[model samples]
Target chain A: MAESTKKKKKGGRKKSDAEMEVKAEEASEQADVSEETTDQEAIAAESAGDETTDEGDNQVAAPKRPDPDWQKAEKPDLSLDERLQGLEEDQLRQMMKDMLLARRFEEKAAEAYALGKIGGFCHLYIGQEAVVTGAVHAQTPDDYVMTAYREHAHALQVGMEPGVVMAELFGKETGCSRGKGGSMHMFDKERNYLGGHGIVGGQVPLALGVAWAIKYRKEERVMQVYMGEAAVNQGAFHESLNMAALWGLPVVFIVENNRFGMGTAWERASSLYDISQKSKAYAMPGRVADGMDVLDMYRVTKEAVDRAREDSGPTLIEARTYRFVGHSMSDPVHGVYRTKEDVEEHKEQKDPIRLFADVLDEAGIVSQEELEEMDDEAKRISAESVEFADEAPDPEPSALYEDVYANEDVNGRLYFDGRERP
Target chain B: MAEITYREALNQALAEEMERDPDVFLMGEEVGVYNGAYKVSKGLLDRFGEMRVVDTPITELGFTGLGVGSAMVGLRPVIEFMTYNFSILAFDQVVNSAAKLLSMSGGQFPIPITFRGPTGAALQLSAQHSQALEAMYAHFPGIKVVVPGTPADAKGLLKTSIRDDDPVAFFEGEMLYNIKGEVPEDEDFTIPLGVAEVKNEGSDVSIITHGKMVHVALQAAGKLAEDEVSAEVLDLRCLRPLDTDAILATVAKTNRVVILEEGWPYGGISTTLTTLIQEEAFDHLDAPILRVTQADVPMPYAKGLEKLAKPSVERVVEQVNKVLYR
Candidate 1:
């Protein structure tokens, strides 16, 4: 057998050196199988008839065959000049500023969560700014955006005010959801940001439905639905993909593969490490983009958004990125599944905001002083959001009965009339 | 007026709604081309084409969520579930997404969707396929639950359900689909939801029921009249926004009451009606309100066992006799 065909496990270190040595010996022995028998058995297995006659009956069923078509989408490698080719200086500055704003806003949210000002699950979008920022930039205002719980950046990119979003986190009446929905349920009807759905992969089908509505109305709009890598395992994800492809709905499913679903790594949970390739089963084009690079994120998503707008079909784009913080505010930042050193290394080397700043500086689009000022402005806005949330009034007790139904005739009767119990 | 079967009435409602509004569409498993599992959506695909009448894969969660999403953006979607038993697969979407989206989103999105299908036991279909799920769905706050007893009511209520601006679980009794009744020929005919109808009025006893049980109650009432005892039958068309006024007025007239339902006794719709009667018409009642409910067990496949599991005409008469002290 070819040595390359022997599986090599690649991940964390083994707990014991003795165990590693034993595994290596076993792997070497398995790689010594005769090449001729392997080829003959392969031909026999592929043959149409079920013949009981076995030429190499004793040969251990060739270890489960790998998916031959399983190949990762090629990552584009554009030169700095090439990356900056089509981008205007103003647009580049705005994208960098948006990334910076998202980072600063999340940092404030984390601090507020620790201070007990914010409650429920507060998933910070610290290192994944470029994914939402660039994707939002590529789509028109008519486009719809739906995402999972980790969507503070998405809410901001889709034009929800910082104060209203923070106020929602504070559970105040002035919040976008009128304090009914907390951080994970942020919604803006005017902006066409569907929601920050709490259920994992729950919004995939809903997004397709929105796309269906757009197509039904003959509107030239696309729906962009975002989910995590881990959500690909959910049945709704596959169901939605199939329906979208079958109906030719105008939707782009963006999977932000940040490597970890909470503490469980993507490799630990999924058999297909490359989630984008799963789109092939539904007969849709799937692509991968560097999530840390804003320009690349925009370029790939723009193609998808255009295809959808033209009523071609749905596309699945997997954005490769990393999360600098833990899964949510409740999770400790380090020393569990991931180390503190790894977090620091990602922050120092590939922080999306920092990467965008470097690109801006190299292109001489924005100077260091201007970047520092932008950081200060973002900090000011984030601090004001905290103050606004603190000052916002609590929802009235009567507000509890509101919004359950749009038909007012059925609304506002919380209890049975003249009855002691509801 | 025209006499038609319950299935034909439902088909007419879907056809009319599709013709009335371009935004309205029907999608579900076997709803198109295959002509629906129960033939309730028969001829819709041929009439409206594939776009208006969609044939979805057997994905209840996906298609239900899709319906909710479409409704949120100003389209009315009629999503069929083949049967209420299979709707269990889409329970999360129905309860969490469709029902709660309006309230959770602060009224920004109103799900104008109808989840329609056959409910309750049919012949030998047992256990999973035989559940009457009105009590389960009516428990949620934001969604409406409507169960029609006759062909006319089926057509009217279904049209109302589709036109309503909120999510509605329109449950059609599997056993009642073939029953014929006179329905109005008006294209705009729609019975308002949350209203109860007095199918039969009598002076002796009040029998309150919904869906197929309404027929059973009427049969029991007929038998009681043969014995010189009069009985009134009140059909509750909608379960969620229950018609308390109609219930109270019926109790006032008859002075004695018996509640009948096909669902299990525990936490069933009968339990709610009993509480309402005791609270509002306690002084008018001559005896304690009695309830004839299904046995509290999963429906069995055996014909005898299935008959015992569901409410029967004899059981209703027995409950009425006990309430009347006759």
Candidate 2:
């Protein structure tokens, strides 16, 4: 009887620790709950211009966001006429459908991988769908796009065939990289999507280089590079930013601040999490957006991308957002540092795709039946991709000799003397 | 034929290469209106103007990365560090980004960049300011390491480096720039990378060295000649993808070898050459390869101590004598 009482006492102790985590998440999503992390909230608010903290030296005031005076912003009148006004309800409805389908697809990827179907590090951009969807839909295929490893949504929303990407993830020869590069290395140079880079801050320099190339070749191309907030701490980020600013390269640096770097929250890892404030260090324009809201992400990114093409130099955009899943598929929500309450709160209260769909429904632009139809289409497409990946042939043994080098110096011959294609 | 200093030959190479390719340009701290820190690029700015010949700020990491980024975009940027010692600050851009880009990108990207500057020790420059990093750089791939020992080779190699499809570390010896030599009169002349030339051919034993140390070996060979030892001297122009065939062939013929490198003895170029000859040319029955290198200590400012720390003709002679006698 006494031992049973002790077990009950132990259970009570576990419940309150869980409660403290719940309180932390609620306090984090809504507003301040912890006094120690209050400075982060105040700075974030200042960055968005939602609040001002006048009494503090620690408070980094919102940047002087010299947004392009769009009325005076130069564009060929013919080009402006051709620009997608994004005013159509159908167009918005279509984007909403894609976003929702992507949401379901990612959530399923998490579940499917949990059953051991996916083998690699599978990072889901479930909460931040709007970042890519909004930006990708706004740009034409001629523009260049590159992003970090949390890139499945970037690839899908960029209109890369889902089947190819899924097949690539499965390490099949028919996949994007012919089974060599898994998820973090999907690239389509033909489409001007320069990469999917694995290193955190390494891509920043390379992308700026691409922009420099575009300008040098007199090609009117814009290079958009995506990275996380924690990557800003690295030296290459700062070094590249300074050169880009000085040279006035046509590049856009986007920071997907999903509130955490792997397991540590931005508050714990960053003194100033709002990357826009740090953009001042380069003397470039910095903008903030509700990363969960597609419309806001669209407006800001479009403005930045236009400025870049106009040869007005680079812009740094910090998308304030959250991630619904763990850093990767292998991580479990309960077993990790984050509480289940936090993930549940994001899934229930602030689902970006759901939020956008709700807006369209209120406007009567898209109905429940139309949405369900798109969901079925996406699910079938996803299922077909998985099947295609399973069927995709592995690379031939003779392919090892190819692409290792350019033509050799002697007689312009191939470098490797290996089995030829049979 | 024309006689010119290695410095003048280098300037001439830059002038000719820039004239040939509009995409080729140069940028460094003191290379422009201020001339060059080594006076190697003395009159380039007036000829090329501010766009092609740029004077950069003191941010080595920033500008070197800029040069690297610029190179990836089809611009052939010849970056001049004040010296190899200063290049350490931008080593990441040099080694990680430029050297590894071609291989890691799976050969999709080519960075046509060149980092040229004075390397190794000269006189009493002292420790923090002096180092010879040939072996360290030779360890990496996708980078071509060129150390020219003569005026003709310097000009020809510099020309070839500017046109190569890879990043090149073209190190000029500080003390050898003003040394005059007979250069080819043919304006269209060029030398390919990875080729070693026999500076002085003899049969008793082969003395191998690169950069300024090549001069030491040649002088030692002359001294050994008086003692009836016909010491062969090989000037290793390109260090990486080392003319191993040439080294091995010379060792096989001479049947004895002595390597002279300017850097400290530990993991120096001498060690690499000795290891390779022993492994590949072991049956050639060499009388134990001898390495004459800088003493295993930090270089001191005292002229006497600095001279003692570096490879000298006297030491080279002793090593050659040891190999031949043994």
Candidate 3:
């Protein structure tokens, strides 16, 4: 492995497409073995004139041999499931339900967007639910927060009602932003969440500036700034990191590396695939956590945030995660760019929420029946949110002009009778 | 009750505002320990602590953005660039984020920020540093651009700017900051944005100007006064949301108007004001409106050439006389 790491670093002088294609072909070869076994069963069934119902389980038990070179040393199994090592069975089950609800809510948002009930650029937070819910629970309520456009889970994690979030998505007057920012711009100022910025790399420097104020005003607060891998490639990320490290600003830069950015994979997007190593350029501590694992994200972000509160400067965490859905609803979930097998493998083998439920069941905290009941409870809660948003009122026409300038319409009332607002 | 220079008025206004609001602070290169390049922030660091009075690294973009971000979270930050030429280096932050935040946030955020520094041609500090950008800055909304002429206006308007909910790009005349006038020593005093003052009233010709050029126009009016040509001088305090009523009324009464701007001749404030007066008060004008402005060429660092590049008292006098006689 040491020799291979050396060879990989030495061979890092711009890999050719042929090499990457060769790697992909080798990985698919193992999957071809499974396909071949299924094909053999199909042929046997055709010859026998009766189907082999137990063929899948038979193939799985024949030889448990996974491809050696094709296998990625299974990422220490994303400690989120491990950290629930001994959580009370009932509590663990509830958390898994929260994660399931978050994932379901995101799926519904994608459906809503397709139905034209949601508008603007909607970046789904389906696979990264555990990261938001876990980190949010560890932070103090008064702690300042800000993130880029993929922010539905952040709002939900901070305990915003699903109805208000959906109402904001629908641009209703009852929205957190008063229907001003349809989707990419919703902010709950009362929650200390600055905004859901649309510009790709704009939040880094702004969040750094907030940290400066925290240190300047001597406030016992820290900020969690979320950015995508695409933004980490931008100038603001480097620029803000330099100052944040230089000044010892109270901040935790959470880079949610969800494998693919828009359409490009992480290896295609970043020269340094391991982003934590890039943090050394600014002389700050950078850690990597499995974003799929909620407990792992919570544990690491909590340490970084606590250190920030103690005036220990900044920390960067590169949360390695994946998106279950496409970049936006417009993207094809089963397209040629990604194989269906690759997704099914993650969904079955390493889902953060599913694994947590298994831990709870194994601990006898909640049986399978009890877990199903929690899912039912969450489904009912989510079904009611759609109706609440649909019934939410639209902001008045005058609302368009009201916020342009502060109280700029002192004389505007003279143009009409004061009682005509309705 | 003491008469002070426009520069002293600005210093006093900062001292007062900082004393008044604990959240208010000033930051810029050379603003604190070095007094200021122009001494406009002199004695502030002494009056206020280092936190309230800060000296920043030579980074306009960094400090300007810091001010904007701080303002968003309920801090009042007064950022001074050495001059408007340096301030232009941070134009993207100034224009895109600070000014657009309020409107883009749908009024969720108020940028109670003030960016003040010297503007217009300073003899010998030319070309790189002596450009006027009021027209460039006034081009943006969600920001109020104030170019104060007199000491009274400098103090009052600056106080108003510090208190304004919107970001205010306040201009301190490089040449006229030292010029003296009676600034009312009142605590609760402020001149509203978008209001012009009749610095000197007359009937033959209405001469409009702002910033350092206001002094030049008043001087030109003194010369016109000797020639029995009564020139009314309008000091446009705020350029955006310009007090068109004062300009139109004065232009109609005088029937002749000459607007002087220290910027390059093309698309100067003179062009905007001349077009506005001509369109609004065209029938009342006996002679065509005229504009006296700087030479279109870049201001050379040579003292004599720098003076030649900017609109001067002689140039303002020349334009006013031409408009009045014609």
* Isolated chain B TM-score per model: 0.98, 0.98, 0.96
Q: Which scores greater on TM-score, model 1 or model 2?
A: 1
Q: Candidate 3 on A275-361: residue-level lDDT in tens?
A: 764676787767666677776676567667877887547888888766777777777764665668876776676677776677567
In candidate 1 chain A, what residue range of length 10 has the lowest lDDT sum? A1-10
Cα lDDT tens digits for candidate 1, A304-381: 887788754898999988898889989887648877887798788888888888888998889999999999999999
Candidate 2 interface CA RMSD, Å: 4.4
* Cα error, candidate 3, residue A160 (Å): 2.1
Error of 1 at B260 (Å): 1.5
Model 2 / residue B101 / CA error / Å: 3.3
lDDT of 2 by residue, B1-326 (tens): 69999999999999999999988888789999888998888898999877678777676766676677667557888999988888888777777677755544434556888889998887778997778877777766567789999999999989988987778899899889999998886768788777888999999999898998888888888888888889889988888646777887898899998888888878788887777777678899558888898899988999889888888999988888788674
Positional deviation of A299 in candidate 2, in angstroms? Answer: 1.1
* Residue-by-residue lDDT tens digits, candidate 2, A295-334: 6677667767777877547888887777877787777653
Ranking by lDDT: 1, 3, 2
lDDT, model 3, position B154:
93
Where's the lowest-lDDT run of ten residues in candidate 1 chain B?
A: B272-281
Each model's TM-score for chain A is 0.81, 0.77, 0.76
Q: Which ten residues in a row have the lowest lDDT in candidate 3 chain B?
A: B97-106
Q: Which candidate should be chosen as best, given TM-score against the real structure?
A: 1
lDDT of 1 at B261: 87
Expressed as tens digits, the lDDT of each residue in B32-132 for candidate 3 is 89999888888888889787888877767667777887777888889998998998767766887777676656678878889999888776876888889
**Model 1, residue A113: C-alpha shift (Å):** 2.2
